[model samples]
Target chain A: MDYKINVEGQTARIKLGGRLTFSHHREYRDVLNQLMSHKAQIYEFDLSGVDFIDSAGLGMLLIAKQHAEASSAEVVLKKPAEEVQRMLKVAKFEKMFNIIQ
Target chain B: MGVLANDVQLEKNQGLDSIKVKGLHNNIFVNRESVEKSESDIKNSYILVVDDLEMNRKVLGKHLTKAGFDNIEFAENGEIALQKVAESNFDILLLDIMMPGIDGFEVCQRLRSQSCYKSLPILVQTALDGDDDRSQAFAAGATDVISKPINGPELIARLHIHLENKFLVNRLTQYHDRLADELEVVQQLQQDLVPNEEQIAAIQKNLSLRLSAHFQPSSEVGGDLWAAHELSDGRLSVFLCDLTGHGVVAAVNAFRLHVLIDTLEEYILDPGCFLTELNKRLVALLPVGTFATAFHAIIDPRTEKITYAAAATHTVQIMSAENMQINILEGDGVPLGILANETYETIQIPFPYGSSLLCYSDALVEVSDSQNRNISNQTVKEWFHEAKLKKVDVVEYILNALTSCGITWLADDLTIVSVSNETE
Candidate 1:
């Protein structure tokens, strides 16, 4: 798994690639730390490259959302692949984050 | 005439005395105090010297012998060197680079091509001092290089270092093999902790219940566990537990819970008390970061009631055979081992004849399809309703449906248990 971060003004765009599961906890934590340190007003996660996710992956996203909210920032999930979008819908993630096509 | 014979005999005596003196010098070289400590090491190690010239081979052999290395072999050329290596095991190889048929560099490269000789140390002895020759030797997999006029002490030190490393590698390989064997045994033992088919059948027969279950681990061992015990008072106690993670650590926790439940058989009638006591034991025994989610229930056939308590977030559903309706029971308590003083609550419901109660781990709801959409609880309830309408075993029906829908691999350990009252 890999991530590319692009920061412009107060918005940070993170593009995640590869499978998002329990095994990617360390990498996800590192990305989370980077997001917190940047203190971006808006955080956008680009899931276009992600192919698969599991229950633990949903839990990780929830944790990330909580962290963003605690820091007074808003998070949006953008451009998810078809499969990723379905997983998001199944987990009812739309109620938690601002999901844009 | 007598004086002449005496002088000839004196000359012969002097010749014998000179030979004895040379023998004494060789003995002194072999028995030196400085090399006494390494005598056993050198004797145990086998050294191979490959050189085309007979005189050079003799000189190298003599030096090695004097340094207390009694086991030495000679290879006149590269071809013979390869043959000897294949036939016997040598701790270190001393190869002379310049040979007629096959050069030392070619020999080293060929030996390194074989997996068994990948870590074998090949010391190159070259007469040429050019940088090109040294680099070429290294590129051909030479471990270290020595100049033509070999210094005895330097050779001995290099041999000792390489042999020590080889011995260490051998020891580590042995330890790895032993550990793998032990883990295999442990894996089998962990599988044995679950209730076998015969035990499940006997429980069903004795308690007048129709029980069916399915269990699969992502690896050799798993954290999911289920057991059904028939109480003496015509009651049945059933429980399923899923630890935080999977594999050996989770399997060990499952074994602990199995033993703990056996010890607490007296409290099996009260769901709330059993769960509370289980939480207390888990909080004391489990590590800080580990916890278990569980569902424990007691069914009384005479009263037709089920009392259950859960320490997880998964919903347990009871499908009514009367109206083909599904009633969901939500588990709202915290997972076990998380808090020291947390209490659990139990809910009682009527287990009417022909009604089935379904219990499953999170892996069931988390199962995804080809499009990565998870199987929602509503879909599962619908399947249960269909199974009830068809009068089939609900657990087997759901599993077969999932398999037919391309949901083969589960990301985590999965266990599903269903108990239905067969008495109508």
Candidate 2:
């Protein structure tokens, strides 16, 4: 998996591509570090390019959200693929993040 | 001069000059004795001398020969040295710095980069005595250094030390690899001991109960085990056990339990007796600081009742199909292998047609949430209640819920066994 980060004003947008599973742990941690370093008020993870995600990947997303919230920042998930959207809905992630179509 | 003339004639005519022949014989005998005396010291250790100057090579060769090292090869530059190293295994390398094309340091670094040569000793020999040069050689992976006009005693001492250490490391590596391969075979044997799909199906068919189970080990092998047997009185005896630890030790314990239960087929109908006997055996067999939590139950289709005993702290949930009511059977006694005289109590519950019983290891309730804290048992109970209302497979529903809640890998071994009386 790979990620590209863009920051504008107080918002940081991280675009993720490829499979988001346990194998991408290091890359995900690096993205999280980048997000924390920016201290952005709003963080958006664009998951349209994500083709697959396992339970570990979902757990990591939750960790990222928790970290952002602890820093008084808001996190939103945007443009998830169809399968990713179904899994998020099944896991009831809407209770945690502001998911956008 | 007659002897010299006679020696030439001897070579042509196969005739001998006695005095000259005796001298030749003495020389051959002396040479053989010397070679035999040094053979053990050398042991055919191949040493490479990398020097651009032929004179330096000859000097080192003579010193090594005097030290009983007969097997030596020469490489004029670092490039040639690397090529020679790749071609065959050399016990030690005597490298010279300041050579044309690919210096000694670069050769050492490149050799170190390859895993095969990672442990090969490269002794740097140089005339330059700068601190920077020494540090650079060390940084580039030179094992040891011999400074200018090499000291014969120091060179021999360093070579002996490095060669011994290298051989020791190689032997250790071989032992480690062999041990790993053996462990893999043990792991496979343990995994094969678990009930396969065909065995589960046969048990389900014989017992007239819908059975579903999920077993996931935290490692290659785990302590979690579940088994079902058809009792003599036509009841289904099912049990789930979880040992205190994971991996090989736990797997061995699981195997022992499996064999023990299979041997105690007569006690299956009485849950209390079965658990008592099992606990007694475990207390005697299990090592200190190790114990097991288990739930054993007998399902009698004719009597429409379930007799069960628990030696764990985890609650067993039963969902009644008649009214969709969930009943939690609280565990009452200490885990097995803890108190030898502790007797377990058997609880009887209505196992009417269409009722389902869920038995699981603590791994189910011990799953961590997003904040890394364990998800409460209350939350798990609520999910079970919801699953019961939905009329879903209780085991599948609980495992799926846990997975959806971000529990991909369990910290402990997980074993969930669900038995439902579907006969209407």
Candidate 3:
């Protein structure tokens, strides 16, 4: 998946698009770096553009949340696609992160 | 007949009777290639000097000894030269082309025919001006060609090149063999991590459940682990866990999970709790940024239901035996080890008689379809039903179904386990 991160004030909004799977670790690392670089109180993962997400893609989200939580930052999953939402719900990410409808 | 004052041959001519060198130039670095120990193996190199005449062997041996080549042997004919090499290991062969019986070319060809002497360095000593002999020696498998009336320094220098390259190649081959053997052990260990055929047969003996599983790892050692255990409560508990990446580290993590799962025997009937506790244990056990997507389910014959909780896994499906209608199970929960305080939802569905529950790793659904589209859960379901309708192997049908869909290679390990409450 391709992601564009925009940090304004204390909010870091990461817009992730396309498919996210095991092959995207290299690109996902950059987003993790962006999240750690710009410390923010609110980190939003814009997953609405992601059409499909496999287990590895979900694992990447968990990785992001772990990084975000370490800094006492709240990682919010924002605007997930229906399929992505179903994937997150199946994985039960609601317990870990607050999904923004 | 006047040699240089320093014992070096100053005059070069054929009339003075050049050393009639005869030996087999062959790649003899075989079988015991990498066994050479110590840095002086090259200098302490055992050399075989072959010639047809005693004068020739003595003359070359003198120059060889002067060049610090102490370990030397001689053969008066090519036949003896071939026999000596066949019996013992020589670092290099200084072969003389001119011989009475078994000429240098014939001896060299004979040695080359033997696989052991394939890489043995055979330096053919001949007339430097004879292009025909030089090419023929090379064709007969000579590692190199050195002229007769052998210059001591030139011979030593050429020997050093062949020996160094030969040893270096042996070391590389040794390292490669070691890695292959280690990987084989790990692959076997990975195979052992899952339940074996005997265990599956034991489960089948219960008569309440028909179980079949297939695990095909990609070219590498993958992190897919699955097992089936008969619960003390007359239930069957099975789980499939696929770690993030593959290879040694992922394999080690799988071993850790295997050990941890054994400790969770108390939660055999509770699929949700089993994963929750497993997740907590994994969080403490696994390093940060690593996790596994898994599915744990308990099959109860009394209730005829399957209670399962999935952590981002795919292919949690159940096929009805009556109509062969495949239903998808929503694998609910976050991946294990990602969150310390995570709750996996326990969703129970009816497992009517003649119904089968399938839980597989994501590798199945991630493949492309026949139309070049990625095979999703829906496509897999259709393929499963198609397999059942045709009365063929479901897993094989579905896996091979993607062959025309551009799934020429398995991108990841494919693992699937099915438990059917046939009761018949």
Candidate 4:
């Protein structure tokens, strides 16, 4: 997966493109870890550029959100790709995470 | 005339230093120290003495036993000699060509027919002094021809030659066996260096890379190497390298390149800067006159842009997405190990949804037909046209073309990697 991070003050926006499978988990975790160290209460994850995602990738996002919440940072999903949106709807993660279409 | 004590003393001193020997029809030298050590081992180095005359056998046996050889078995004729050879392992065979039952020629041929004694050294000790007798002995697979009465020095020299040859043969076989084992390990290491199938599939889905690869080493070890890793910024960096030589030396350099790439993956950010660091490391570490041709490119899937750089490599071609038109990417940089602190420039190419870029080693182009003719670029271009610009199976097609060109074996290591906009 390709990642582009735009950090504006305490809020950082992350954009993901491609498949977020096990191969990308390490790099994805690193991006989240970098975000968690900040004093921001909100972390924006943009998935519009993402083409496909598997269950493992969804689990990774949940973990990232949990970690962000512990640090008083809110992890929100914004502008998900068509496939990603369908996956989130199927998993019912849209209710737990603030998923923006 | 009476011999002086000084001459006797000189002979004794010479005997202490060296011994002239012949074995397997070849002259050999044996150091005195080694001869002493071999006495114990001689027990296992048995000999088969074949002669029609019992006296000849007895005298020869006594001579061998005096020389520290322990087991000397006798065969009265050629027929009996064949039987004895089949039954046991004998290091050397002493045969008389004029044997009664079966001539030495017949026995030697029979022994040679069997797989057991194909290389067993055969020395002919006979009273028949004709040139024809000597020729016949050789034709019968005789290792050496010694006319009686045999001098002790000649006998010892012939035996030493045969044993030395045996030791050398065994040593060479052992060396080759070890090389094969090491090749297996190197192959495993090469496999580990490549990104696994699952990883490639994952990256394909993300970057839409229309990537295909074919890696075949001509020998047990080769120099062609390639690696792909996702950068921290989500861009994928794919590198393909071919070291200067092939075999063990090339393999070592390829491994070193792997380590350099791993280190760069952890530390370096920009593709150009990464190559600079890699080149510096290679120049410092690799021996003079040795270098590598490398192509490193980073593809940002989100931006649909690629920053590509090459060092002493064939140009990377970008096929237009709309049509099959090709644009060659020419990156100017000296090959690794050629310059110090040399900065390399990368060309930013807009990789749209349906196009792909192809990077290949010189081996693909450096091919000659069966008549030893260079394969022209026009032929390659025609092949590209036939593939419909979709390089999903281009590797196989190119290899098949090269094979048809009469180039049965690749002279150098070959590597080809293509990243196209994934249509699937």
Model 4 lDDT, residue B12, Cα:
21
- Please tell me which model should have the higher TM-score, number 1 or number 4: 4
**DockQ-based CAPRI category assigned to the predicted complex of candidate 2:** incorrect
Per-prediction DockQ, in order?
A: 0.05, 0.01, 0.41, 0.01
The local lDDT score (0 to 100) that residue B398 gets in candidate 1 is 88
Q: Candidate 3 lDDT, tens digit per residue, B358-413? A: 67787887776546676778887887778767866566676677775668676778
Q: Name the Cα RMSD for model 1.
A: 14.9
TM-score of chain B of each: 0.70, 0.77, 0.79, 0.85
Of 1 and 4, which scores higher on DockQ? 1
> Could you estimate the TM-score for every candidate?
0.63, 0.64, 0.73, 0.70
lDDT (10s digit) by residue, model 2, range B28-134: 11233223333343456799999999999999999899878889999999889989999988988999988989999999999999998887888899997999999
Q: By TM-score, how accurate is candidate 3?
A: 0.73
Taking the candidates one at a time, how many backbone clashes does each contain?
Answer: 0, 0, 13, 13
True lDDT of residue B162, candidate 3 = 68
Q: What's model 1's overall lDDT?
A: 0.77
TM-score of 1: 0.63
Best by DockQ: 3
lDDT of 2 by residue, A10-87 (tens): 999999888776546667788789877888999999999997664446656766877888889988999999968855
CA lDDT of each candidate?
Answer: 0.77, 0.75, 0.78, 0.70
lDDT for residue B328 in candidate 3, whole number 0-100: 81
Query: What is the C-alpha lDDT profile of model 1 across B58-174, one tens digit per residue?
Result: 988988888788788999999999999999998889899999999999999999999989988888889988999998999999987777788766666566545545554565677
lDDT of 1 at B321: 63
